[model samples]
Target chain A: MQRTIVFDVLNNDNGQVKAILGAKRFIEENPEYKLILVGQEEVIKNTLGKYAEKVEIISSNEIAHKVISPRDALRNQSSMLSAFNVLKEGKADAILSSGDSGSYITLASLKVKRLPNVSRPAFMPVLPTTTDKKMLLLDAGANLEIKAEYLNEWAKIASEFHKIIFKSNKPVVGQLNIGTEDYKGTEIAREANKLLKEQADNYSFKGFVEPSSAINGDVDILVADGYAGNIFLKTLESSFLGFAKLLKQIYMRNLKTKISALMIKKDLKGFKAKFDYRNTGGAYIVGLDKVVVKAHGGSDEVAFYNALNQIKIALDNNVIEKLKEVFEQAKEGEDE
Target chain B: MQRTIVFDVLNNDNGQVKAILGAKRFIEENPEYKLILVGQEEVIKNTLGKYAEKVEIISSNEIAHKVISPRDALRNQSSMLSAFNVLKEGKADAILSSGDSGSYITLASLKVKRLPNVSRPAFMPVLPTTTDKKMLLLDAGANLEIKAEYLNEWAKIASEFHKIIFKSNKPVVGQLNIGTEDYKGTEIAREANKLLKEQADNYSFKGFVEPSSAINGDVDILVADGYAGNIFLKTLESSFLGFAKLLKQIYMRNLKTKISALMIKKDLKGFKAKFDYRNTGGAYIVGLDKVVVKAHGGSDEVAFYNALNQIKIALDNNVIEKLKEVFEQAKEGEDE
Candidate 1:
């Protein structure tokens, strides 16, 4: 299949550099794939250098920054919208961004085409876990609040992705809660458990999983609402930093400890490498018609390389095509 | 000062045996303190054994498990409430429990007492950073939904405790949010930032902290609502386990890695010790009239010993008295 990946550059940040580099690499490696970079004219040209022909400057004045609220994206004729417009017009196969996640999500959902039967699209980040692997946590920050039924849908969607990408025959899907029991969480958890139990064949429906076990690679798909998922992601990010900071403090204490640290730098590096989010590709806003992936705000060149690889994974797995089929199947089953 | 510590056990699993040992040690160390063990006749007798004279067993049919919900504690008249009654009658200076955290907090608040100028009590857990040094995080699992104003109060309360115990001249208090800036987070964060800015002296209110950087050991007091804090605590707990699991998996990958792991067992042990929650004592229910600490549900003998040490710290610091003084001072300032 031919691949045409576009970067909707709302600002001149590390994301833009990454998208361009990733696109260039993709074209060089895959021959059949085309890469397009869209942003301000002078900025895109300057960033692309000799590869300026492959990159397209759409010339967008609307800027989306961390300060810019999601509502602002709706009012402004932003680059974000322009990038999605290209996708809608079949100019690009997918859009990858490391910009404002909220604004981009809102723009993609409203302006870009949404897949049928997806009431709310989820920004799912496949986070690395301590169990020497990773799990796909859905709705990392898409919907603020979640319902049990919606969570059921999230479980199905995430499970399908796991089966398609990871090739798990019956990927285990667990609901994120405080405890691992049928009646562990608040009202939503209990109801979701009931719904998952009824459709046990399609999903593993592994009851409740505590936060500690959720990222242990014990489950393939972890389902949570946007609010909880966002908190989870931020907390995980903070905890890694906290642990790193603590280690740095201990190593810096006096001359004796500093010597001990030098002896273990290799071990510490191995540890740090395990939790580095940059190695993982951008998070996908699943349940959209076209592939939309959100990169980290502080993503560097290497991280963009990871994102490019992830886009291929999504493309090869037929993420969009599988989603449409599953949602339609769910609806048809419900109608019966 | 004369100290009378009460231990109530009904339906407790080996609690009487543990409490008896703990009581005997305390009596042997500090002759000024008295130990009152409240539980069943035969079980308490068996636990008391040779130290039966030092331990006083008051007959009570109340059992509090970590799994028991608040409603069960409320409905079971003899269980948690009866233990609280022991504290109310001036029989005990503090109540120590290896039981449920929720029950301990609720019973301690409604039955024993509620502190002045405090609407709801909160649990403050000290978490270790990577360097193995610990920082205090408040509302670990007490208040589910709280406003920015409540966060300000929580910060104040946490600051006072840290000041008294940790003896930091100017305790830095930070509101946990998604990012560090003048403007960020949900509406609650914005309001809390405004209040914290005004009372900079009383607290070293260090604007906002990103979730990733919040537990960096730089901030003396980290404050948030219970729900978010609980999730944060859980995530931290899980991430550590995840890292450990991943390391173990890497070690088991082949013979060469297993040999490297064998050489690093001592270093790994040191690293694991730093992440141990048992070293940080137990969580204290702040904004309460009396100091009540909740041990981890799966706490062993070592954790209980830490809880005892925490009780000592609270009493020595006079946290409850300091809270009264703070409330009065704030009230007077408001009135003026």
Candidate 2:
């Protein structure tokens, strides 16, 4: 059976050229899956060349810009919306975009159908930790004010994604909080912590964890209300970026420092690879019926290729199909 | 006039020995000021020696351990509580503690009276940026949920402190959000953003800022609701710590890397000094009538000395006194 992904190869911060190149690479490498490319008809067709015959192309020249309201985002007939429409019409198995997250999330929640027993969809991004493992952080921005039930539900979906995506038997789930103590955090956090502990069948619940634990890779899935989670994600990214910038300045200070940098160039590259966003692919909008991944806005050829491959893994393993069955059965059990 | 600070020398994560040494150093350096030390009397007295005669030592063997309830924190006869009682009784002009933040905040809110026109006290910490100038972040786990009015009030208080501490005539104030976009974040956040812009009277208000702007030191005072602010602070601190740890591992990998390390040792030391917590001192419990600072739990002698210095600067410049007058006038205006 052939799988398909609706690729919104436009509205990227660096322009559509890199996204087009990434799509071409993915198509050339993976013959089992195809992409319905949504972008400027001429550029994508001209770029894909031989691979053009292998996939479908939706003519969409309009790029999605940051809008003032949710209504504006929905009303705009952009490539991102076109991709979502394709996915909503069941024309593809998944959707990928490097567009602004605000509109992407708005479209995901509006267009994508929720899985059984799923209250709200969450933005779950695969993150690189200090260790060899990669972790998942959910509700990073999709729903700032979330209920306790929403967290527990997201945790289950995120853990399923983690177990299949990362090849873990049972992912360790943790609620991101100021402290690990039960007495800390808001009422919603405490309630979610209690619920996760009571229902730890899917994953090994690690209780409430601090941001340090998430960075150290102590848990597989770190859940929080969208506001705190987004703050954590952004700060973690900027701090590393800031630190690397300082390190570069230090190495480029003078001839002696530049030579010192040359001595450990290979090792430094390894360290850089560990924290690079490109290798990890993109953020997934979980709890939806189909795989909805949002690539980085500035994603290059390598990053987009990795993102498509990320979708391929989730599709090949039938993680979404498995989740549908699990959720449906749980709903049935509850009704009984 | 001689000034005094109720120093809770017990409850340090490292131990009371370092706190005593730090006190001795501060007292030696400043003949006009004194610390009403609250800790194991024998140990503090022996460590202080001649300096012990200069400062007041209150015998308190009970260390403030982590308690389950707010009632327990206040009811317990620990050194922290004892120190707070002494401060509340007007025996000292300030208070300093390197204890657990949870109980400390609980005590500060309950024991310490708010300044006139102040709704709530906020936890403000001076943070190091990539640049030379330090920035202040407030409500870092002090009040997780807040109104827009609280943010506006905090901005006024934080700016006053920033001006005196950073010696900036007009500090640049920015409210930290997930994004700089106006249409983003919670209602309170958006409202606060508008309020800050409208009332850019005291300081040069720079609307809403992202975590990146804070790290780059684009704003002098980065304000946010306690939940988001805390998440940002924790993530930033841990990421830098994590990066530093990775860098150390790379340099200690082999003899070649070790030699490479020595070549850049001077530059690396400069980078380390910039991010070190000891230099930045401690977090201020702002909006209180008296100057209250919370040092890092694992603070050593140098860190304690810096924290004392931080308090001294606040006291010497009469920042608290000025704020009292300003807030009192505002209250009177509001009454009119």
Candidate 3:
């Protein structure tokens, strides 16, 4: 089950240094995975000292920290592109970047290309389960305009990935919308529901699901377009912050409240940990010819290390190949 | 100012009886507001008992509840229609209903009519503040499709309302959008920003405000279309519940956690109190000729009573008249 994976590190924020250190530490522990850190030569080398000899650093300051547009990746010829090149050269399994998501998708699609029969690449993050491990949510902010057929494909792809990676026997794929009822969404969602139901034998279609359902581990795979999914994820993130801020206000209210804070400090930490995006790692841009993961903007070493771990599993399972097979079969079935 | 106001209370769910009882208590404490409990004669009498005499219970078993559409109010014999008749007759200063919001808006608009120069009615709710106190968030779910001109009017009306209600000298009006940048939102929002800026003398037109900014209490009046506002309100409600649930799970994890929960239980209660929507009166359907409030669907008796309290204030201030005056002044300024 052990697999070797390359880390395409982009020098953007402090997250890059953290990611480098995380990948090195992970490689040191699991000698099966080889580490390739790509960014500013001196910066990557300085941050990654002892493991510096073991890790390979690809240098290119072409790409700046914060990419303004997807066009910038093509025009600027930045570090992100250099790391992407490594994947194109077959030297690395997949590229993981904490840089601009739009740029990541743009570069991966134009350079790495799409799997046969795939229209658009979808970014899916595994949201940590409130009780158990995690659930994968797709189109977090990748595919803007998606068809019913595309969602069906996403459902199939995510189902196979969940079963293979998470080891779920029969992964439940739920189409997300404003409501769970059949006729509760926009024209696209409603149409998608009908189409997905017709091909229920191909995948486990759990009907429609609401935004609240996504957080509760109701389904193994939650599907939606980028807009709704973006709002869903951002809301979760902000809500976590809101609750944290509220807790701080309560504890800092007065001397009595401060004294009481000691008692529930551990409990509060446990509560906050459930919403920690860091533990889950970066979202994989699924339905692509080659694997690409978009790490969180504020990701630390642990999160980056986790992304590297994700890359290894994704590579070993040949997710892209499995997805391609599903796409072909699904398309043939549709035509018939 | 001691004022006598009547409530056309609609008993929709099991909590209706309690809500009525809470209003009765408030009526007794204030003696300023009289209770007009409208519904089935038998149920109202059974619930209120001796206090039923004080409350003028007009018999109408055919009360439109959740199952009934807002259009059902158009039916002559419906209880909701009968309640509006009371307001029309000057029997009630302001009508408060905990029934379906859509039905309330539909009937209230027809019965009360729109304020002069106001093309569409708006509903504004006082969202719970993360700051020192709460602020008004307009069109919370009133008008779905609003023009730039309508938003400009909304700002003026909201500013005047805030001055009378919240007592802000120069009420800060902000158009809600994704970001604060010059060109962050849709065409409607961008134009609203422009219009608001032009009329800065009337409304302290702040720049675009984010969802977090609304909660952060940076502005007095936050205006947006119903669709976005509905999503925003629901997001906040769902998030509060989700976070509370997470905290409960953490505290009940083990004996140690339970012990910690006991220590912070008081502070946690205080923290949650900040978000208790029950304290604030129900949402006001603004721009209507007559004053109307939409109490929370799951609101208890205390919340209902709080809503009834606002009825008298709305009546005394003659919010409808003030809204008309504001609109006239705006038109005059345009003429000049």
lDDT of 1 at A266: 62
- Please write out the lDDT profile of model 2 over residues B38-153, one tens digit for every residue: 99989998899888888888889888877778899888889999999999999999999999887888898889999988899999998999999899999898898899989888
Task: For candidate 1, write residues B126-149 as lDDT tens digits.
Answer: 887654346789888777677767
Candidate 1: docking tier: acceptable
Off by over 4 Å in 2: none
Q: Please give, for residues A233-291, the per-residue lDDT of candidate 1 as tens digits.
A: 88888776765665566567656556656655565576777678787667888877787
Q: How many backbone clashes does candidate 1 have?
A: 10
Tell me the tens digit of each residue's lDDT in model 3 across A65-129. 43445676677777777888787877776788888666787778767767778777788888864
lDDT of 2 at A329: 79
Q: In angstroms, give how far residue A82 of model 3 lies from its true place.
A: 3.1
DockQ of each: 0.37, 0.84, 0.32
Q: Under CAPRI classification, how is model 3 graded?
A: acceptable
Record all residue pairs in model 2 with backbone atoms less than 3 Å apart, i.e. clashing. none
What lDDT score is found at residue B117 in candidate 1? 65
